[model samples]
Target chain A: MFDIRSSIINQKKYKVFYAIIPFLALFIALFIGGVLIFFAGINPWKAYNYMLQSIFGNIRLFSEVFTHFVPLVFCALSFAVAYKGGFFNVGGEGQLYFGALTATLAGVYIQGLPAFIHIPLVLLTGFIGGAFWCWIAGILKIKLGADEILNTIMLSYLAILLINFVVMYFLKPANSYISQSEKIAKSAYFPKLIPHTQINLGVILSLLTVIIIYYFLYRSPYGYQIRAIGENSDAANYAGMNILKGTMTVIIISGGLAGLAGASMLMGTQYRLTPAFSPGYGFEGIGAAVMARNNPWGIILTAFLFALLRVGAGAMQRGVGVPLPISWTIEGIIMILITGSEYLSNKFSTNLIGGRA
Target chain B: MKKSKVFLRVFVLAFAILMIFSTLAMTAPLKIAIILPHAITSEGWTKSGFDGLMKAKEDFDIETSYQENVSEGELKGALRGYIAEGYDLIIVHEMGYNDPTLEVAEESPDTMFAITYGFKAADNVAVTSGTNWQANSLAGAVAGLMTKSNKVGFIISNDSPVAHNFLNAGFIYGAKRINPKAEVITTFVGSWSDVVKGKELAKAMIKQGVDVIYSQCGVVNRAVIEVCEEAGIWAIGAVEDMSYVAPQTVIANALAPTEYLVYGVIKEMVEGTLKGGRVVKGIKDGAEEITFNPLLKDKLPENGEEKIMKLRQEIVDGDITLEQMQEELNKQNIKF
Candidate 1:
C-alpha cells in the first residue's frame, strides 16, 4: 500500500494508456450508435452517409457547422476552466442568458459609436454581466458554506426568467409579434467571414480564447496553484495557497467564457436576443468539457465533433427517415460512453500506477 | 493487430457502401422538409401540422419530411440543412421561425418557404395564418348566451400579445354581442403543457363564477376541461375537434382547417399559381370554423347552434366585423 516509489515510476508507462482512452471511447460510442441505427430498421451505412454528405459536402453547410462550433468551444472551455479549479459551474446556462440580456441591452441602447469602440464595449458588458451572475454563487459558497451546485442551478432559472421579462416588457420591439428584442445596432454586429453563411468573427475570437486559456492553464504559475487546489484543497491550503481566492478567480473566468458564447450568438448569428436562444448550449458545454477531460486543446476537437453531429442531425431526418429524437439519442449514448470511459480509466489507472487495489 | 485489421476493413467497406447510397439519393423527386418546434406526435398543434404535411405529400406525390423538437436557436441551422439538401419547398411550422425563415429564404431565393402564423414575408416567402379568431368569436357567442353566471373564462398558454390579443378580444366581443351583461375573465398558465397548473387555474375561475371556459391551452386544455366537466361548467376546445377528449364536457371545438390550408398551398405550388405574400383564410374561406359537440347539443341553450351558425355566416359575409366587436367591448368597458 505504501509504494510511492513504484507509483512515481509507473506514471511514465501510464501516459500511453491515457492518450488512447478518448479515441477508444469515441469509437465505442459510434459503434453503439451504429447498432442503434440498425435497430431503427434503416441501414446504418446510409444514415452515416447522409450525415457526412450534409456536413462536409457543401461550403455553405460546412460554414453553418463552423458557425455552431464557435460557441461550443467557448462554452466547453468555460466548463473546463471551472472544472480545473474543482468548481462544477452548473450555472453556465444562467450566466449565458444574463450575458446575452446585457449584451442585447447594450447593443440596443448604446449607439453613435464607431464599430471599433462599440463592439468591444458590448462584449465586455456581456462578460461582466455573466461574471456578476456567477459571482453570486461564488460569494454564497465562500460566505455561507452554501452548495455552489444548487446555487448555480437556481441561478440558471432566475437568469432565464430575467431575460424573458426583459424581452417581454422592456427590450421588445414595438408592435412586433414575437418576444424578441430589436436587432443590435449595426456597429455592434460581428462581421460575417463568409457571405450568405453565418460564420463570423466569433470563430477567430474563439480560437484566440482557446489558445489563451491553454497558456493560462498550463504555462502560468497561477494555473499550477489552481491545479494543486483542485487535486487537494486542504493540502493546497497547508502549502499557503489561498483556496478561496483561487476558486473565485477560476469561476469568474469560467463565467466570462460562457458569456462570450452568448455574445457570439447575439453578435455573430442572431443579431438580436430571442427566447430559447441558447437551446442548452451551456449545459452541452459541460458534456463537451467532460468528453475532452477538461483539456483546453482537447475541447476544440470535441466541440467540433459535437457540432458535426448537430448539423448533420437535421439532414439525417430529411435525407433518411430517422426521427429527430434519434439524433438526440445518439448524442446521449456517446456522452454516456465517454463518461464511462473516463470512470474506467480512473479506476484502472489507480491500480496500474501502483496504488493499492 | 488483428482487431485493428478487422476494424480497418469494416471501415473501408462501410465507406464504399455509403458512397453508392449518396449517389442514389441525388436522383430522388422534389423534396419538401418541414421543421416543427414541438414533437410531431403531440395530438394537438403539431399533429395538425403533421397531418397537413402528410396530406400534401400524398396529394402532390412529392417527397416530404419533417424535423421535430427543434428549438429557436437551431431554427437557422435546420433551415439551411434543408436548403443545402436541395429541398424545393421548406415549411417552417411555427411563428417563432419568422425571422430565421426570412433569413434563409433571402439566402436561397429559389427555394420556396411557407410559414404558419407568420406575419412578415419576402420575395420567396409565403406567410399563411389560420385566423382562428372567427371560430373563437362563435364559441364566445355561445358561451355568452348559455352562461348562467354571466362570467366566462379564457385560458391561454402564453402571453404573446400579438398572436393571442385578437382572439382574446374577439371572445369578449362575441360574448358581449349576445349577452350585454356578460363579463369575461382571462387567465394565463404561462406554459402549454402544465396540466396541474391548468387545472388549478380553471378551478379558481370556476369558483369565481365562471360558468364557461374558452381554452387555448394546447394539450393542457384537457386539464381545464376536466375541471369544468367535474364542476358542471362549460368548456370550448381549440385548434382541432377536441370533443372526443372529453365528449360530455366540451360544448364546441374550434376547427382550424390546417389540412386544407397546407394542401391548398401545395396544390398552388404544383400548379405554378402560388406567390409570395400574406394569405389569411378565415370562416369565409373555409380556413376556420366552429363545430358544436353533437353529444352535448341538447344540453346547450335552445336555438344556440342556430344563432351561432347565423353569426358565423354573417362573419363570412362580412356582416359582423372585428371593429364592431371591439366597439362593443369598449362600450361595455370590458378588457380582453
Candidate 2:
C-alpha cells in the first residue's frame, strides 16, 4: 500500500514536470529565434517587439488571431481526446474536409427550416459526417487489424477528390465558371460574437468544447477507461475493458471533434466552401496536441501559441519585410526544439530516478 | 563583484558588435525585396518575376533580394519585414496579395509596393495585371475551330473572379462564334501546382469526350498537356509558350510573356514613369498573344490563321468588344 502511494506521488510529480518542460523549451526557441533575427540584419528586440505589437495592437488583427484560434482549439481538443485513449488519428484533415462538405450540403439542400433548427442541423451534420468517416478507419483497425495511420491518410486523399467531385458535378453554382458549391444559406452561418472582426460564436463553442473534453477525459467513467487503455492496452483488456468498443468510441469522438473544427471554419469564417478552405488546421492540431502533451488545458495554451505565431507571422511579413517562408522555418524550428527538449528531459529524469533507486 | 564586471564587459562587447553590423547594413546601397507566390524550382512563372528584379539590379545598380513560395497568410509578414528593413521597392508576385498589400500599403505609405494579377490601388501601391482574358479568348477561337469533337475543357486552378472571367467567358464566347453547338466543360484542381490532380481531371474530361483542353493554370497545365498528348487530344498552354513541352498535341498557347511586363514595369519604376494606379495591359499593348504550335501548323484548318488575324484586328479596333462577344453568345442562348 505504501509502495503504491509513493509510486502514484512520483507519477504525479513527473506529470507536472512534463507539463512545465514544454514552456521552458519554448523560451529557449525564442532565444534561438532572436539569434536568427540578428543574423538577418535586423534588431532582435525591435523584431520581437513588432511581432507582439502585430498580435495585440489592433482589434482587427487580435480578432483575426482569435478567429484562427477557434478552429485550432477544436482540432487540438479532438486530438487530445483520441490521444488520451491511445489512438493516433492522422486523418483529422480528411475528417475536417468531410465535415465542411456535409455542412455545405446541409446549408444548400436543407431549406424552409428556421434559423435555430438550420444552424444546429448544419453543425451536427458536420460532426456526424466527420465521425462517420473516422469510424471507417476505426472499424478497419478494430475488425481487420489494418493500420489506422495508413488507412486514415489514404482516406484523406479520397475525401479531397470526393469533395471536388461533389462541388463540380452536383453542387455547382449557376455561374459554372468557378467549380465550387453555391453560397451557404445565411441562416446556417454562426453569428459574429465580436462585430466587425470575424470573431464568431465558434470561439465560444471551442472554449466550451475544451471544458467538455476536459471533463470527459478526466472526470467520467468512459474517460477513465480511455486513460486506462492509453496507459496499457494489455492491462486494460485484463481489467475487463472492451478494447474494440473503446477503440471505436475514441476514433469516432476524435473524428467528430475534428469535424467540429471544420464546421467552425465553414460557418464562422468562410460562408462558402472553397478548395483552400483549410490552411492545414487539422494537421496543425496534431502539433498542438503533441506540444501540450495531450492535456486539454495544455492543448488550449499550445493552440493559442500557434495562433499567435500564424497571426504574428502575417504581421511580421508586413511589418518586418521577412519572407513568409521564414515563418514556416521558425515554426519548424520551434517544434523541433520543444520535442527535442522533452526527449532530453525525460531521459535525464529517467536516469536520475534509476540511479537513486 | 569580479563576476559582475566580467558579465558587464561581455555585454558591452556584444553591444558594440551589434552596432557595427547595424551601421554596415544601414549604409548598404539599395535594398529591394521580391516575394514570389511559388517556389523557384516549381516553374518559370515565379522565376520570371525574380528575373525582372535581377535585371533591375543590374540596370539601376540596386541590391536585389527575394523570397519564394509565399502563401496568402504569410504575405503580409514578408512585406512588413522588407518595409522595416527599408527596402526601396517590394514586388509581390501573386494575385492573392491584393488584400494584404492594401493593408500593408496603409501601414507603410512610404514603401513602393507592386502586385501582379489583382488590382487594389493606394497612393504608394501599384497594381499590374495581364490581358489573360483577351489572350484566352484568342486561344479559344483557335480551339473552337480545331476541336474534332465539338467539346473543349478548361482546367481552372481555383475559383477566383480573375480566373473565371478569363477561361470560362473566353471559352464560351469563342466556342460559340466558331461552333455554336460546342460544349465547354471546366474543372478546378484547387491548386496552381497540382499536376496529378490536373492530369486526373483532364483524363476525366477526356473520358466524357472532351477532345481539346485549355489549361489556364501555370505549372498544373504541364500534366494536362501530357495527358492530352498521351490520349491524342489537343491542349492549350498558358503564360509561356509551353508548346515545346508536348509539341505534337499542344495546338496553341495563351502567352502572358511576364518577362516583357516585368521589364516594362521595372524600367518605368526606374524612370519615375510608373503611375500609382491600375495598369491594364492587353493585346493592344502587345502584352498578351496566342502562339500557335509549329508542330500543329499542318493540322490547322485552311482558314484558321486568316480568321484569327481578322478577329484580332476587329478586337483591337473595338469593333468586336468582349461585351459584344457575351451579347452574341446570349443571343444564341449559349451557356458555359
Candidate 3:
C-alpha cells in the first residue's frame, strides 16, 4: 500500500519519508548485525572495522565489489520491470542460465568474428534465450492460467539440471574433472578496464541500462501502459490496451534483462558455464528489486549494497574469523526493516492526512 | 556547491578511517592461510585438509587462518584477498583451485603456495601430488587374492587420467600381478557425490560377478559399501578408514593420506626447501598405504594379508615404483 500511490496523501512529505527509509533500515540492520557479532563472541568493533576497510580501503578491492554488482543490477532490473507490469517473474535464475547457456554456445561454437560483431550477437542470443524461456511461463499465465511465480521458481531447478547435463555430457573438454563448458571466445569478452581486476565494460553497460530503463518507465508512453496495467489491469483493459500483449511484452523484457545479466557475467567475469554458476544472484536481485521499490536507479544502489555485504562477508571471515553467515544475516535484516519501515511510514502518512485512515 | 563541500569532507573522513584499519591488518607474522573449496563439516576431502591445517598450525607453532566453502566463481578474488592481506603461504586445498592459483601465483611472486590435487605449477607454487595409485595397486592385489569369481570392480569418481592412473590402471595392473586370471572392471560415475548413479554402478558390477569392489567416489563410497553389505560381498574403502561404515563388507581400507600432503608442504616451508613443482610422495614416504579390516580377518584367505603386506613393503623399498605402473598403464592403453 505504500507504493507510488502513497503520493496521494502529500507528495513532498512522502518523498522525504521514502528517501530516508533505506538509510534508516541499513543503519538499524547494521546495529543488529553488531549484536549478532557480540553474541558470537567476536569484537563487533573489530569485525566492522575489517569489513569497512576491505570494502573501501583500496581501489582494487573497492572495484571488485562492482564485479558482483553488475550481474545483480541486471537481475534486479529484470524483477523490477516485471513487477511494475503486474507480473511476478521469479524465473530470473532460470532465465539467466538459459542466457548463459546460449551465450556459451554462441561464444564457443561460432566462428571467428570481430569483437564488435560477436559481442552484440552473443548478447542478442542470450536475450533471446532468456526471453524465450520466460515466455513459456508468460504464455501459461494468459492461456493456461498458470501461476508464473510457481512455474518460474520450479523452472530454475529444471534449467540448472538441464544446463549441467548438456555441459557435462557434451561440452566438457577431455581430461577435466568438473562439470563446466569450454572457455568462450576472447572476442566475446567484455574488455577489462584495470589490470588484474574484473572491472569491465559490463559496468558501463549496466549504468547505461539504468538510465535507459528509468527513462523508458517514467518518460515513455509505453512504460505508462505497463504501470497502468500493474495499478489496475481491468482499468487498463477498459483503456483499450491489449492486456495480453502488454503483459507478455513486459515478461519478455524482464527475462531479457536477466539474460543480459547472464551474458554480462559470462563476458565480464566467468568465461565458461558451470553447474550452479550464478551463486543465487537471481534470487538476491529480488531482494534488491523489492528493497529499491522497483525503481531502476534505486535498484543500482540496493544491488551495490548486496555486493558490498558479500565482499564484506569474506573480509569478516579473513580479518577476524567471523563466519560468512553474519554478513548474510545483516542483508536479511536490511530487507525486513526496509519493508517494515515502508509499511509503517505509509500508515503514518495516511493517518496524518486522514485520507485512508 | 555547498553540498559538494560536505560530501568531500565525508569522503576524506571515510578514507582516513580506511587507511588506519588497512594498516592495522598488515601486522601478522609469517601467516599461512588455507582456502578450502567445500565445507569442513562435510567429513570428506575438505575435512581432511582442515585437520592437516590445524595440525600444521600446532606443530610448526605458526599463525594460520583459513577460508572454506569458497566457490570456483569467487576463487580468484578469494585468493587475491589473502595475497593482499599478505599471507605468506596460501594452501589452496582443492583440485578446482588449480587454474585460479596459477593466475594468482603469477601475480604474486613472493608469496608461496601449495595447491592440493593441482596439476600445473609456477615459480612460487608447489602442488600436493602423491601416488594414491600405490594404495590402489596394493588393494587390487588383495582384491584379486580374495575374489573367488575372478572379477573385481573399481567405481571411480570420474573418467580422467588422474582417476585412471591413480584408481583404475594401477588397480588392474596389480590385480593381474597376483591373479593373472583376475578381470578388473572399471566404471565412471562422472561425479564424486552422485549416490544413485554410484549405487546403480555397484549393482551392475555385482551383476557382472564382482565379489570384491573398490569405490573412490566420496559420498557414493558409502552407498557402494552399503550395497556390498546388503549383497554380502567385499568392499575396499578409499582416502580414509571407511571400515566402520559397513564393518563386514569393507574387507580392506586403502588410504592415500591427503593429510600427509598438507603436512609435507608445511614441513617444506619450515625447512626452506619448498620448490615449485609436483611433490610426489607415496608408501615410501608414508603418504600412501593399505589397512586390512580386522572384522573380516577370518575371511583373509590365509597369507592374503602377508602377500599384500610384502607388496606394500616392495613399494616402500622402491623395488616397485609408480613409474613402472605408469608404463603398464601406457602399455595397456588404459588412459581414461
Candidate that would win on TM-score: 1
- Name the best candidate (by lDDT): 3
Candidates 2 and 3 compared by DockQ, better number: 3
iRMSD, all candidates: 1.3, 5.9, 2.6
Task: Summarize candidate 3's per-residue lDDT along A56-144 as a digit string, tens digits.
Answer: 88777777788789989999999999999999999899999998999999999996999999999999999988898899889999999
True contacts kept of 1: 0.73
> Residue-wise lDDT of candidate 1 within B1-336, one digit each (tens)?
999999999999999899888887775566777788777766567778888889888777688888888888888888888887778888888887798789778878999999888889887998888765788888789889779989998888776765355788788778877887889888877766778988999889998999999888666777788888899878898888878878888998877746666777777777778788988889888788888899888987788778888888889999877777777667867766
The full ranking of all candidates by TM-score, starting with the best, is 1, 3, 2
Model 1 whole-model lDDT (C-alpha atoms): 0.83
What level of docking quality does candidate 2 show?
incorrect
- For model 1 the local lDDT of residue A68 reads 70
With a 3 Å backbone cut-off (N, CA, C), the pairs that clash in candidate 1 are none
Model 3 stretches astray by more than 4 angstroms = A1-15, A140-143, A175-179, A339-357, B1-28, B132-236, B243-250, B306-336
Candidates ranked by lDDT: 3, 1, 2
TM-score of model 1 vs. true structure: 0.91
Q: Please tell me which predicted candidate would have the highest DockQ against the true structure.
A: 1
